[model samples]
Target chain A: MSDNQKKLIEMIVGMQSPEAIELTKVMLEEGADPNTILDICRKAMDSVGQKFEAGEYFVPELILAGDMLERISELVKPLLKEGGGGQKKTHGKVLIGTVAGDLHDIGKNIVTFMLDVNGFEVKDIGIDVPVATFIKEIQDFQPAVVGLSGFLTLAYDAMKETVEAIKTAGLRDNMKIMIGGGQVDQVICDYTGADGFGLNAMHAVKFCKEWFGVKE
Target chain B: MNTATQPTSNNELYAERVQRLNDAIALRQPDRVPIIMNSLFWHTRHAGLSFRDAMYDYDGLSAATRKALDELQPDAYVLPHPIMALGPTMDIMGYRQLKWPGHDGVSNDVPFQYLDKEYMKADEYADYIFDPTGFMLHKYLPRIATAFEPLAKLPNFPSLYYTRIIHSTRSFANPDLVNAFQTLQKAGEEMGRMLGKTVQFIDDMAALGYPLAESATALSPYDLFADYFRGSKGIMLDMFMRKDLLLEAMDKAAKLIPLQAIPAAKHSRSKGVFIPLHWPGDGLMSPDQFKTFYWPPLRKVVMTLIENGLTPIMFWEGGCTSRLEHIMDIPPGKCVYFFERTDIFKAKEVLGKLVCLRGNVPGTVMSAGNPDDIKAYCKKLIEVAGKGGGFIMDGGSGIPDESKDENVQAMFDATREYGGYA
Candidate 1:
């Protein structure tokens, strides 16, 4: 990596604003391919996710780092498309969203970042995503996995409904469903008929890896 | 030796009662393993009162607590607090009125107004820590007034002066601030005496345990100072820049707490002091941040309580079994952890030998379900957590006010039926 690419990686890791964008510009000027820059950003974020899992970092830090990565990805996206590197194969596709009636997004956001780093093409549908959105996204993305998050007791039902809707739509066999959040439990997961349940962010990653039959 | 025939004296009875509870804890063989529903606001509400009423009325408070105890009938009575009047008042004055989104009297929206836009900006921090009384009177009080317009018409208008003075000391000039803080400390000592006396009266009559005091784990001391004293945005900057000052402030806060807590514990005649392990869970602070920012002060507080002859009951808010091993270092049996989302089996497997374990019942089952559900759930919890003796039964978090009284009764009934010495 060139000095600018190194600096861009640091900026992204440190979640420093303007510094990240400026470093991205410098890397681009240094003849760094936009695809290469995206790769660097992804690597930097993967390290952040690892640190988070290892207990060296926290939610705010993850959020900050994820934001920086998102900004860098936005900057490099056009370039990746122009370079025809946009169609590069991802490990798998994931459709992740917090269930309805739950506005909390921090947990969902962390899972999204972790999946993103693990080479999963994560499509985060943000907070309070209705069941219909999950159905539509699964139909459109046809992602290998569907992850639902809810932090409230009320939202657990929404999670169950979402799962039932997916199954009713005959998508259960094709898609792997995972559920988590504060109000979730093994019983809830079984009742909801989700394929798996993750107790925390680290567990979510492990669940995904196992579900996809990927080592590590 | 008319021990069998004559009625037992209060002291003898109280001691025997406490001993029985401790024996259960020690032997892991509590007859109907004691389950304490450590609810903050709900206990008060269940007594047919409001937050303001519970804070001030000792008799009313004691009565409500007694009622709950009679209703639940756990093997032991763990009194987390007869009344935690301070933080809630500050929360109401600082942010919005407190609300209980769930049972367990968990107070939400502990708000703080920011003194500076950037908390870590040392240059601007002084401006952020100004006279809170005037601010509360001018800005927050009016808001409270409007919110409680009907209540405002009542006599003896409530004032936020105390909370302002308590929170505003960081902004004062050195010598004045020091002198002011000393005077405040003396005043607080006096207030502690009064609070203690009130608590002691309750203790004498009810024979209850101590009040459990916990903060959300997401709140580091720095977070508390920033969120409760400074604004969120400002505190974020403060964490990066004025890190030293933030640490110093936390140390100071930590030191001050024990002074009042000791007296309160004495007053309540409590054997245990409950401190919540909130932030070490998955989505909040990492274990690293917990070790760095949270663990030290918490250890200090826990150690102080133990040294002063009080047991430390740690309420692990979300899943904290992952970090229970780290907590084992804090002097065993001096602590009893109440878990919410943690793996109880793993906790029992790991920390069971080290400290007493309480809780793991899902609040949802108690709040929304029937007695049979509660009975079945308690039976399962007892089978797992009740194995060798250091386990107590409780709602996973707290019993919501809306929870069916019959469900609460069923929890106690199940404990009696299944949680025996055998």
Candidate 2:
């Protein structure tokens, strides 16, 4: 790897504020491709996540790192698209949101960030997202995965409703459904007829990878 | 004189044995599995006493607890009550006077009373600088005094008056807030005397569950402020627009908790505090929001409690196991996380050695299923979580008001029958 590439990786992994953005700029200035910078940053975040899973780091550190990585990614967005890489093929597209009536998005955001870092084209619908929005996003994005997040006990009903709606739309067979949150359990997922249930952010990524047969 | 197994008349023996349970918890071991009873309300109901009656009637409580020990033979006892009395802000402001339908203890609805239609529409309520006393008297007190009359009579009536007058007089002057909080600290110290007596009495009564010490409950400053102080939408908007104000409020609220918790820890048999996780659940905030707003205060609260010689036993409502690995950041062994729907096996693998793991039995199973089913579930949980010494077996969540007696009996029976270090 080039010195700038290595430095970009370190900035993303270390989650160093200002430094991450500055380093990304420096890498771009040094003739590094924006796509290469994005790839390296993604790898760095994945590395940070692995450390998090291995108990080497905690959530604050992971979030800090994720934030820094995002900062660097935002800087490179315009440059990457100019190189015909912005609309490049992704691992798979995902339509993700927290279910209706439940505004919680922490787990969903973590999952989205991880997915983005891992190369999945994610259309994040945000929290308190209506079921129709998920349907519309799926139709528009034609994503392989539709992930639902609900952090409330009451939102389980909405998740079930979303799944039923997807089935009613005759799109169930075309996409995989996954649900997660504090109130979500295997029982709820089974009852809701979701394809899988992710117990946490890391597990969600693992679930998506397996569901799509991604080689990561 | 070797009456270790024999029932003793003196309550002091019970206290001594209970102290040992605390020591064991500190070391992460007990003579047997320590069963922290599901809920104090249920315990009181099982003893055929009102929640209010149980709070003040020490001898009656002692007798009822003795019967429970004789029957259940648990490894420890977890009491139900916030160790410290109300803080000046909560007490004096009449926030403590708020009530809910089902429970006898103070409810978590104090902040909601301050929510006027105007407050919600203000768009800047988040940045609306908190004039503690002004917010209380003009906004919260009338609601408390009128809507929650029953709560006003419970205790700490003086603090409510102080809270009203101070807030009404000055927008943010809280000179007495610290002193009011100190009063709770004083009360906690006095509680140690009662706790010592209760422990001795219970230890002498039977060879039951270990008598463990724990706070009544704990709350993250984020939850305390957002759910109780600023309401959800207001807090969220504030985070975006008035980040500085929100941080200041959080910092002020955070400062009070540790100071109050220290005395409570001193009185606790286990030197532990049970911080109940309320928000950051499925419907409350997104995982990103949790990382931004919830985790910081939670981390701060957990760190503060740990730093102050108190262990935080977090009772996480909803399924928090998804984020369990992240929670492992707080100093290990300084906290024991109790969960509602978290993956028990995963928790064991991830946080087992680092912090004590309590709970996993489905509350529904205990409430609706038969004894055999309860036994089967408990046996499985024990098989998975009981392999290590740091695990405390409990229902997946708390035992709700509707839990069946036979099912509860089966849970205890299964533990006694199948749970041992053989």
Candidate 3:
């Protein structure tokens, strides 16, 4: 990363959305490598995630960072066709959601943002997602991993039912299933028949990497 | 279910249990460890009644509750707040946040789900802090319930004050506003009657020897703001972007709650005030955030209640691993802290001498683990948390509404088997 590129990374990490957006546009207009820009955005997001974990930042910052990246992606995608640098070829695709009857999406949203920055193609089926949608998305998206997110105890039965439905439909063989939520534990994982549980969003990145045997 | 123990005619058994529980709260060793449960609509489901039944049939539901409590005979049980049980009025109010059984899309067995959306807008923090009651009357109520929608049209306060003084009839001249006031009055009367009956039922239960664990309930100011008002996404952003305003709102809420709660909880059986603490756990915020946002105002509330001779049962929702040390700031034997996901044993170790530790074996174990597993789990909770007479046996969270009878029965059975202090 060049001096200007490093400056852009710091701006993104600082959550200076307008400054970062303007810098990316200027850097690109002056012909900075799109790969470096993409790389720096990823690193900046990582910094935001770390701050969130450390309690220096919070949900609003995470939401803002996600928005910044989305805006930056729109700007950088057109210029990176030759370098193929705008979209890091997804290491793996993952389908994720908070299961039926659960309205909490904070944890799931954070994981989705984390996965996006870490270069995984994530399909968030959104909160209160039913089993049918999970199956449809699994078949449609062909994700390597499936994440069931729930914050309530009732979602336990829903998760177990969804996992069982997938097994009955013969889709379980194709994807690795993971459950993430505040209440989920090893016992909950076994009860829901999911392969593992993610303690937090960053833990999710480590889980995906461990599953695919890849390095970020 | 064993519906056999009714506390002998002199009410000795009931007194023994109440004394036992109160003793534990006072940091004195009782005959044995007492179990205090939130119950959390589990009893409604346990008796084969739907959550809908609890809302509609007070007599039948109270009978069901009486029957269930007679069987398990917890040292004492936390009664459900009757305000949430008024099905028709709540539905008619078009309360956007709560999904009740039968009337809402929710199934019969499921309890009411509190859906947190943005009721208080991000821009309204100043209004909320400056005049909360005024804001709640003219600004907040309209946004929260459809029944109060007409009030939203009332000009902002001071303007409305002047209008009320100048053209008193103008307030009622708007036919829609008149209709709204009538709806509000009628609904208030009906709700008051229903809530009155519920309070009567609780008194009757107390007369029958089963005292309530928490007669008064207060939502922590932080949660009141984060949950019902700004929501996690909104308030959290405010925390980063507008820290002072958020804290101001929280402090105002903390001071205002006692006005609604303390006077109303004057029932003879009302002992401890219940404050459910959410969003302070390690999962939601870090230690520093918790110290800054949650502890100070809530602690002040607890101390005030204590000075006024009320025990405060502070239930820690989610987990409290990050903020356990801060929990120790309270005076010894001054309060009871019910933990959901916090390590109860570690809590006992940390704040055992300071506050009584109640709870929390994971609620899932009842349905997911075997009866023996629950017994073992309860035994472990008793062994670790029951030391020095500061622990009560109960679910980490409330019992899941779907937990089986045998699993829940194990809670009492394990208490008898392994929880005896004598």
Best by TM-score: 3
TM-score of each: 0.64, 0.53, 0.91
Candidate DockQ values, in order, are 0.20, 0.05, 0.43
Best by DockQ: 3
Q: Kindly list the per-residue Cα lDDT of model 1 for residues B311-420, writing each as its tens digit.
A: 66676777776676676676656667778878888888887877788787787676556888888888888888788688877777766444567887887788777876
What ranking of all candidate models by TM-score puts the best one first?
A: 3, 1, 2
**Native contacts recovered by model 2:** 0.04
The sequence of per-residue lDDT tens digits that candidate 2 reaches over residues B1-422 is 11235445335445655543453344365444546565544555578865445554566566666665566655555654332112322332334333321223432211011221222223333332454434444454444433232221223323457567555544223444444345545555656656665667635544343455465456787777666665554455455445666676676666667777778667644567878777655334455667767778778878877787887888877766557656777665667778777777888888777777788778645554579988998888777776646667777765543457788777888876776554
Docking quality class, candidate 1: incorrect
Cα RMSD of all models vs. native, in order, equals 9.3, 11.2, 3.4
Q: Give candidate 3's error at residue B69 in angstroms.
A: 0.4
Give a tens-digit lDDT track for model 3, residues B26-76: 898876888865575678777777778887777767777787778987778
